[model samples]
Target: MDQRKYNIYFHTHTISGIIIAALLYVIFFAGSFAFFKDSISAWQKAETHAKIIHADYNYLIDSLSKTTNLQGRDFDFYLLNSRQGAYINMSASKDTTISKPAAIKSKSKRRGQGDGAYFLYFFANKQPTTYAEGYDMGEFLYRLHFLAPLNQIPIRLGAPFGYLLAGIVSFLFLFALITGLLLHWDKIKANFFLFRPWSKWKTVWTDMHTVLGVIGFPFQLIFAVTGVILITNFALTTPFSHFLYDGKQEQLFEDLQYNRTIEVPYSYTSLDKDFDLNAFVSKWEQQWQGSPISRIHIRNFKDQNMQVVLEAKPNPSQRFAGSGFVKQNIATGEVLASKSPVEDANYVDGVRSLIYHLHFGDFGGTALRLVFFVLGLMGCAVIISGIMIWLVARNKNNIPLYKRRFNFWASNVFLSACLAMLPVTAFTFIMLKVLPEINQAAIYRVYFYSWLILSIYLIALRNPSKVNLHTLLLSGIFCLFVPLVNGFTTGLWWWKTWSSEANGIFLIDTIFLLLGAASIMAFWKVRKQAKSFQVLLGK
Candidate 1:
């Protein structure tokens, strides 16, 4: 509360917030939608998660076996992102001396065709699709939350540049939040109830920034910490692994329960009995009824020493945080190791699950996720207001003209980048329905290119009021078109989807419609107040 401490806190907070305002806005805006990632994916494909049947792994494996010998190959089936399907990750056979399975050429540009590849197999359609083909706006926005697209940038920073940058921003965001809280510590209680939307721009932005920042502090704090932990695991864990585990990073990961290695020798002799994957999976599923099987790994394929590893995580609603792992020998039906997801939970499981659930809002279902999404958007509001406050605070006669100009330019660029995302995202969603192609490349091109064009245009305007108003107008139009085009293309209008009880698909249409309505309402209000809101700060 002292003057010296207050000034330090104020300066550090301002610097950090300004440094990360734009990127943090992207993270919040994209992450808010990511809360509905599954719903968005289901909506795009016109499929209901509740209605779609679970994957028919047996049929998929059988179909795959016909194409390539299933023997001696290692297989990993992941249901983490499965929607009426399973992910198949087939590895080359462990027995190098034996004849290998038929090589399936990878259709992706990332890697060459070898003895293996991975793809999603939809049981409803009875077909397979590569990850790129299966990519949807849900995945796009989810990955965009942490700037995954930035990974394509040719940069080396001793780690993935995108992830490393995201982590650094997250860490700095935490510092800013702490400093901001401290700076306002004396007036926190009084400011908690303050609002002055009709006041001068500076006071209005300052009040909004402080009030919302305080209100969303805990929520954003959780996100900041978990985000750093999630994105910077490489940077944070490396030193500890090097020291404690003697550079055996794998061992450190195993100890933390992040990964487990079940080693089984590849016996040359083939198994005499048939390996029934369905029966094996079904048996475990039945035994662990409430806990979902997260992953299944088969090593050595049909060889005598083949082992099947089943990893399960307790449903958040059921037990919150537990890991279940069972490794069993296929040839002899012998259980080599086992752990109960509900009963055998540990400290690591609790910490890991707590972080994931808190960050993701997965514990309380759709309603809680909606609350989280609203708070995320509120976080976006706080960042914008903070930036505006920074600009307005520097727009005084005492400030140097050049310094004021720099501040205004900084705010202009940051706001342009941040606000452009709203319309660009809605535009991309509309494109998803109308475009002929719907793959990763298509999504990337549409979203990024449109974003660039719109951002450049906004920056050219040089007027923050115009930039804000125009983005709102564009966002309103595009967001409204999202549900309309989706209805026309998929024949699943609001009423029809609601009647069918397809909650997942219905939720997507509903959210976009609401967003469109809100954007339009704000646009109308802003247009009426354009003259007053339009502050020529630098000028």
Candidate 2:
């Protein structure tokens, strides 16, 4: 093997590495929080127990009939009556003679304030493709951070760019892991927790990154490759589908366990005078005792041959079970199919589902998710420390003062943007309630542009050491106050959540505290260092 090629394999281009580092940091960090998107919603919208029990779809139909004309039309009633969560919501089409299903309402709001409007506003402007609507905000942000909304590049172009990044980063991360392990292989028994600050700064950062990278490399590799696989659907899956199946897309879809939900045509004139939703519920509940149906989807609502899908939340361990899915004929109320992962199936379908589970950290219980969360936070730390080490290495060399210091502090400003963006995102979510009509899409645009402007201004401002320290402190204070403001505005807090054990909110609050305190301490150290540098300059 060629030594130069090996170096090329091991060390990525500087610009690419930095961009990948920033993107990966965002994905890992936000994804860790995104893991608990549901919990955040529950906390933000605490539901008071309403006197009325969950009414059946019959009641829903009746309500729509009484409220407005829903006769002789197609619509999907998302029977939240079956779901465990406190709210019930429905989507239906009007009697405008259109056969298509229209979203009547996405979600029911909790009293006082609600986050549904926020989520709705966020997705309204983005206009997600047919496939992307099922996923939540965190996943959307993860994709956006990688693809970065490049209008000049097509999906094919941007998707390849994304995969190339992951492929390259996975290779480098693997290199760092292997080499660091070789360097510390023998000393693992003696120096597992060694942190020698007195040594050269490179040694310190190298040791820190190495240790964390080595410990977390397995997750990093799996997550990076899986994320790449998830994003690059065509690049990874298309070749096999083409070469093996000879261009039969349906065969490929079957092989990959992708179900094509097609609507059957039927007469709209002869329809049942009354539909019984309670009867359907009774049959489903009797069959599956413990599982709760979360959603009931009716397709081709105006057509008499419509199908109904009842999705249930199974046991946590049943995530991969194909049997978890159930479908029924709406008119006849007959069970059509139920499949389980344990049964014999194509090997590829199993792989695809497992890949999704692993990427989302949904395979394991709370323990595994917590482990994933910790590693994700450590990944963020690695990016910050790596950038710091780069500047430190340059400064310690026999270089000019202006060049060395300018580069060092300029990098710090970018770091500020990366670290501070989380609180800014949280604030934006809160603002959705405070100002519902502000057009969230425009707000997001302003948020990102403002961050860039702030970062540039910080880099150009004089006395950068003091300014950098102040920026860090400002970030720390903002993060610390997030939960307090949430409580004041929403009337929910971690302490009060003890009775219900809202682990999601608890996790967010705890992580915010830890990050805020660490940031404050880091800023204090920088402040001390700035004073010492000024004293030396005075002499």
Candidate 3:
């Protein structure tokens, strides 16, 4: 490329890098860990720490029926067997009769509302153990990736703003990735294996950034594109529904569901006390055979016009194929609408499923998730090093310190954000393990406050490099002690958990221990670099 074109590409890359570096770092860091959400959740919750054993569906149905009168009411039963242990979540709402259309609309609306009055029945021993509401550690970290940026905004605006910000950042990330490739097109092959750690700081950072970026290019692109699709879908759904669907959001939903429509109106009438849930289960089992039932949604329960929807477990081979639905008429035991299994899903349905699975890294199980996590951290490294290279280039070009004061401040904020993330996350884990009884709201408060306090302290220092070093040291200390803290508080020591039913907890503890050691090493390296720089400056 000519000088002018090269300069334009470089400028575009740098500008985009600076604009989204911090946000990208935050997203990648938190999201990488989200791959192990269920494991982390199990690790955090004492009730779910034991080895998981699948519960008998017959027993589950019978127990739920006896405990909670399952006739003519809105209720759901969700089954899962993962690192979090095999459990059934049963939820029921008070009886309310409405017209069929109204019931359908209400169901759609309630989808986004919180899961109400749910009980988790764990199948640890031969008998079932029940756990009510508790803090979900996995969900907290997962939400931080996409929702933390909007925490301070008002609820009405915050959600949209969060989705918009995620979408915009994803778009710019793709732009930056393309520009970076173009700028280095000629050197791409050579740079793929290049790493000059012993060279000048800027040169070293440039090489590291290039190598990591190229290595994780495919994963990064997948994440970026899927992220754009997911976030923008949520952000723009309302507007699109207004313009394209005649202001009916339900119509948009119908279009996405392959234009399938359920217009049957509910004719409300009291039902007999002997509602045959066993028959419903039997029909479902006959249809799906070996496939485990993941969720069961019953609308207008106990009423003659009740509708039951059963969702089968996701197929692992089909990345995008989620649970298939089988809707039934409760009054007659007749199948109303049966969506094809995910394995045989067609174009539209498959694409929708693929988007969700890819974005969430839910398809490949633990091995794939580990690959994603490592690549995600490398992506974080790419962003951080790209910013450092820019700052270093600015210093080398003799940019006036006064004129670049704002840039300097922004750089500090960026570094503060990047460096503080790990420490804040580690601290949150420690807090959750140590205070298992804490409320959900309070757990998040601890997370946001710890992060905010550290960030403010770093920014107040007015020295990005110094702040980075200090934060690294602090983060290292916090991380290094995480395993010990977990053991002390939970009494589920790593050595003891390995051979027990709590292997998930054991794995989590081991990861934390390794991370702590890495943090400490990073702290030492940063401190040495700082000392070397001070000597060079004759400080």
TM, every model: 0.97, 0.72, 0.83
Please give the lDDT score at residue 157 for candidate 3.
49
Clash count in backbone of candidate 2: 7
Per-residue lDDT of model 2, residues 439-534, tens digit only: 325455545665676556655553335445756786677667766766777666758655556665666666666767877888887666433222
Which prediction has more favorable TM-score, 1 or 2? 1
Largest lDDT belongs to which candidate?
A: 1
lDDT of each: 0.86, 0.55, 0.69
In candidate 1, stretches whose alpha carbon ends up further than 4 angstroms from where it belongs are 50-52, 109-113, 530-539
Report the C-alpha lDDT of model 3 over 1-539, residue by residue, as the tens digit: 89998998888888887998998898899899988877887778644345345445456557655544544346556655452333333333334432211121121222222323334544453344333233477767777687554755654442566666777888899989888888888998777798977777778788988888888888898998989887777565788988898888777977676333433344557655455665776667677755566666667666777777876755554434644678887668788878756555666666787787888776687778888888999998898888777766665336665545656667777988787888898888888877646655767788889999998888777665677678777777887677788778778788878767576677677777877788778778777764332101111
**Ten contiguous residues with the weakest lDDT in model 3:** 99-108
- TM-score quality measure for candidate 2: 0.72
For every model in order, what is the number of clashing pairs?
0, 7, 9
TM-score of 3: 0.83
Report the lDDT of model 1 for residue 460: 89
Cα deviation of 359, candidate 2, in Å: 2.1
Shift in Å, residue 306, candidate 1: 1.0
For model 3, the superposed segments whose C-alpha errors exceed 4 Å read 47-72, 76-133, 148-152, 155-159, 234-248, 258-264, 276-279, 282-290, 317-323, 396-398, 529-539
